[model samples]
Target: MKINDVILRTVTKIVVFIILTLSVYLFFSGHYSPGGGFIGGLVLASAIVLMYLTSDIETVHKGMPFDFKLVAALGVLIATGTGFASVIFGKDFMTQAAMKLNLPIFGETELASVVLFEAGVAMTVIGVVVTIILSISEDE
Candidate 1:
């Protein structure tokens, strides 16, 4: 590729990656604060759409290989399972899971089901987005 094309491609990749990372962070943070899974997932999915557009089929096939689809599925399962947990316990949907945390560097933390639900949402959002992008990009 020409130097100009190479520069453009690199910049594009960097920008997309930054946007994707920020979205994931925002989605995760939103669980405690203002953000939540739906918006976060959509933001993540949109970034993947950009990636699908910018990349060729071969590149996407090699890089992701449908893994995102599986991840998204797992995320849904987790979220759904959380609901089930509440129902089984005769509590409301996504009642706190009563969990413990070990953050390594940050040390221990208190974890709750709502936060876990957010994690599931974050994964689902990121995964579904990547999956959609790959599928749509390939369709083109």
Candidate 2:
């Protein structure tokens, strides 16, 4: 027999949103403070895992129709591509460049290649972690 979890599901909805919000904050704050892509990705993965814990795998998979392995591959490609771009410009591998740009919403901001690299790292982490979690759950 299955146990009813209406309350758990309701709370999960709110908690997941909060966690995702925090992850984004952590990702953006990495440039200035002590948070970054790896932590952000872990937080994001936790939200996904929480969802899975609250519901069935099929439902979660239906909502997130992504092949995590592909995600990881793409992340690696993106990260390496950023490095190769520096090489193409006669700089060392993984060289990061930054520039100041004035955008309408954010005003003057420093844009850096490190953000792209971090994004790739975040995606890779999310993919690998989620894949591992799913694989482990499958053994049940």
Q: How high is each candidate's TM-score?
A: 0.69, 0.95
The residue-by-residue lDDT of candidate 1 on 1-140, one tens digit each, is 63346766777788888887877787767745777777777877777677666666668668767678788889999888887788888988766766678998878876666766776877888887776656665553
Candidate No. with top lDDT: 2
Best by TM-score: 2
List, residue by residue over 3-117, the lDDT tens digit for candidate 2: 9999999999999999999999999899889899899989999999999899978899899999999998898898889989999999999999999999999999999989999
- Could you tell me the TM-score of candidate 2? 0.95
* Runs off by more than 4 Å, candidate 1: 1-4, 67-72, 88-90, 98-104, 126-140
